[model samples]
Target: MKKISFIGMTLLFIACTPIRNTNIKTNLLDNNTFELSEISTDATYGTEKNPIQVGGVASNEGPKNERRFLNALAGPNGEAVTYFRAGSCCPIKSKNDPFGSGSVMLDNYRVTWQGAKDTVSIYINMYDSGTLKAPKGFTIKK
Candidate 1:
């Protein structure tokens, strides 16, 4: 009887237990924010469906050229545009600058959802001259 009761209690405990939330981090930026600009939930470093995420766009100069599309890490997305610089220009004119000589950079993005309510931060070690990081990672909820 004692053995049977212990087994039943163990099973009950297992059944009532909840799955623990997991945290994952990845190297988002290596070189050239443009390389990171092409980022998408479908093409992250390792797993395709990481709950946290970030990304956006910036023009070489002038007003932001690309639209913004942001989302959470679990599902919602974030940021949509990027910018890059070109060697043809010098001192880099902010206005009336030719985009041909410039490039788009997409770096700096983050997502928060469910167990993740804090802000997400993207780190870039090094890159070319033309690249813009996202302002801030988006917030998400479960």
Candidate 2:
């Protein structure tokens, strides 16, 4: 009975523990945006539905973080990029969701360049901080 109770408590503790957000301390620039320096090679990096996981801005700064990530990207050939919020979708399991919903929905953005005929869609999860990078077929700002 004692072992069973201990095991049950351990499981509960693990389930409720939130991931630490100590990874991006050095990557942020003045709280205005993130300083991304690499482009993602994984095709699924940005195409894996509406959860790009490209940044971490916590709950209050979620929208701002999404914009900062988009601002860091350029077209395949370094063309000027423009984007707008496409709305929120995809509830990803996250420890950073402040609402205690156990998950956070990602923000979708439709990005386009001056000469591009079609827009690229990216899902962003600002609640969870991940390695920030530009999606494939895109470039990062210098």
Candidate 3:
């Protein structure tokens, strides 16, 4: 009985221990830049092809929810879009047309996550006539 109780306690302790935190590599390559390549970009919406900036967390995720990575997209025409509270572990299941700040012309602009076949790669579709920029800590999907 004592041995069984000791084993139970040991199991509980192990379970309670925090696992090693997974982080998005801030410096993806040899360069210490958090920027990721744009998976796809289209200038067909307008004559201007907006520029994109990227970044992400080096480490940190929470229980029941992963750390949020913010992707900011901005255009030269004073338009900007931000993907807020984006989940790292799970793909967004549905499409959403989130409104942007007044400076951006992204009303009813649709965003869809096509699901990730690879954890290292994120698959997303966005209709942003504006530019995309990420925080000092996040990056766009390469």
Candidate No. with top lDDT: 2
With a 3 Å backbone cut-off (N, CA, C), the pairs that clash in candidate 2 are 52-123
Can you give the TM-score per candidate against the true fold? 0.21, 0.77, 0.22
Error of 3 at 45 (Å): 30
Worst 10 residues of 1 by lDDT: 63-72
Worst 10-residue stretch by lDDT in candidate 2?
50-59
Please give, for residues 1-112, the per-residue lDDT of candidate 2 as tens digits.
9999999999999999986653564266546556777888888777536355644455366677787778778899999899988888777787767889888787878999
For candidate 3, give the lDDT of residue 81: 31
Compared to the true structure, candidate 2 yields what TM-score? 0.77
- Order of candidate numbers by lDDT, starting with the best: 2, 1, 3
